[model samples]
Target: MLQMPDFLTLGHVTRDLHSDGSFSLGGTVTFAALTAYHLGLAAAIVSRADQQLIPELSRYLPNIELQIQPSPQSTTFANQYREGFRTQYLHARAESLEISDVPVQWREAPIVLLGPLAQELSPDIVSLFPRRPGTILAATPQGWLRRWDADGRVWPTPWMEAERILPQIDVLILSHDDLLPFADGNRRDADAILHRWSMHVPLLVATDGRHGATLFRHGQTQRFPAYPIDEVDPTGAGDVFAAAFLTHLHKHGDPEQAIDFANCTASFSVEQPGIAGIPTTEKVLQRMNEKKNLTT
Candidate 1:
């Protein structure tokens, strides 16, 4: 029997392409799996992608266990950015992940990160895991909130299953970018929607890339400011943050402490690129200590 990993991520691992034709391995599954490993968790991934790309993905992920379903083509994304405006295109998509994809032993994983990138996770996933007392079910619902045109241009859409899904999730993490379609770039509108959703999600986090993130739980809200860092690429910072926060919350059960750890960890992710940017637990602790020293 396969040993249960501490963190189990379900999603479609993607190939991120640049306009110049160079591509890198990306997706929440790729970023979150590596982040969990660096944070000292035994991580595993349930994803769908082209069989040939497995070796390449493994090269970046190293020792993490991969339970992949072979697809004719891996989900592919091309991101174009100009003057801070970003446009995304979906080149291909993998199959949806069903509850049956989870291994029996892995069902009780202490932390399960549902990070669908292309609406590839089944809605039934909310009830698939045994809700053991302290288990954490953290979801990044961008996939469910997305809509793509016939030409494959991706855009944000309302999450139709929010009522059914939010009540089941322990922690819900989303970025301002994910909520843009509904909020129409208005901060007040975003906060209004977040306030409404917070009622259902026990802990709801809305991340704003540099300004920081807000945590809403049980009818109250708290803010944590972001750490300043020279950014090389902001690619997987959100994934890193979500993984660190969920793992820390599982171990510590303190949202404030978890958010601080996540903020510090994600700051380092933007300093570099891809897996190279993920900070080790030791590095994260060291930075945290340094911050404490400056204040005292």
Candidate 2:
């Protein structure tokens, strides 16, 4: 019998194309599962991808268990970064994930991250996990808020199912870029939007790259600063932060410490390209202590 994983993430494993004809395996599941694993959790993934990706994924996530739903093509993205902003183009998409794709035994996983890329997961999928204490259901809703044109240029769309999904999740994590369509690039408007969602969700986090993250809970809000670092690639930092936060929160139940640990962990992710920069628990704590000593 297979033992249940401590962390489980459902999404589509993506192929991220770079300039000069290079590509790497990426997606919320890729980064999040790795973060959980590095933090010493038994992480597993339920994702859709082409069979060819299996070898590459196995190389990156050697110890993590993967339940892949075979697809004709893997979801692909080409990202252009200019002056700290990113413009993404969608090239191809894999199959969508249904609740049935999840393994029956994995439903009771203590930490669940619903990370849909390209809106390939239905909102109803949240019902798979029971809503109760000790089980954390967290989501990064960027995929649901996205819509692409015939030309493959990706843009943000309103998350119409927020009302149904917000109340069901224990935590919600999204980037400032994810709020652009609704907030019109204003931070205040973005905070207002987060405030509205916070009323339904127990914990809400909006991460601003470099500027750090803000937490909304218990009718109050707090901002946590990012660990300063020169970034090489910012591709999966938010996903890393989300996974690290969820894992730490599950173990310690302290939102502030979780955010601090998440910020440190995500800072390491950006120092290298793709998943190469994800740090071990030892490195994360070393940096955290370094930051603490510098402040003191």
Candidate 3:
């Protein structure tokens, strides 16, 4: 019998290339799966990677079960950061993921995170699991905002299915950067965008890096402050936040507590690089305890 995982993420595992030709394992699945594992959840990933990259994947992905769809080349990206700004380019893309890719047994995962990094997952994939009590469905729609030029220079594209899809998601995680195109770089414009999107999504978040994140639910908006800490690489912090929030929400079923735990978990992720940044449950609880002590 196939074992069902507690947390399951759907996306492509990426090969991130640097200017010097060095590559690292990346993508939402890579980071989120590790975050879930560190949180002590039985996690699994459904994604595609090139056959040649399996060994590299095995290095970072020891305990996680990977449901890989075969592809000639993995989804590859190059991100160049200068003065706090990043310019991203897509070098290659893996095959699009379909609902058929996921196993029947894994459909019952308590926390389902749909994190498509390159528009690889089909929208219809949402139908796979209907709304069921105790089962949460979350999505990070970064891929829907992406459109690459001929040279693979990635730019934000419009998402057409907000009305149809957002209603299906229990938790929708997005950053200010992810919605910038819709907001036209204006902070005031972002409010309108968030308000529009929140009409369909019951729980929606718009993160603003170190400052904090804004949560919208049931027509009420609340701000969740981020923990201030010295930062290193912010690469997977958002994915880490998404995983932490979903895992905590699954276990605790309290959005306020979950966001607080997630913000605390993500604070640690920005302190290190890559998967090394993901905090263990012990570390997160330690931070939470510290906060409680400070408040008391």
Give each model's whole-structure lDDT: 0.89, 0.92, 0.89
Please provide, for model 3 over 1-296, each residue's C-alpha lDDT reduced to its tens digit, 9 standing for 90 to 100: 76999999999999899789988889988889999999999999999878898666767798998888789999999987899788899999999998889999999889899999999988899999777899999999999879999999999988887778998879899887787777778887877788888989889887889978888886578998999899998888999999999999989889989999999999999998888889899999999999889989
Per-structure clash totals for the candidates: 0, 0, 0
What's model 3's overall lDDT? 0.89
Instruction: Estimate candidate 1's alpha-carbon lDDT, on a 0 to 1 scale.
Output: 0.89
Total clashes for model 1: 0
- Candidate achieving higher TM-score, 1 or 2: 1
Decoy 2 TM-score against native: 0.97
Highest lDDT model number: 2
Q: Write the per-residue lDDT of candidate 2 for residues 155-231, one digit (tens) a residue.
A: 88999999799899999999976886698888788888888889999999889999999999955899999999998
Worst 10 residues of 1 by lDDT: 125-134
**Which stretches of candidate 2 lie above 4 Å from their native place?**
82-85
| Candidate 2: Cα lDDT at 52 | 88
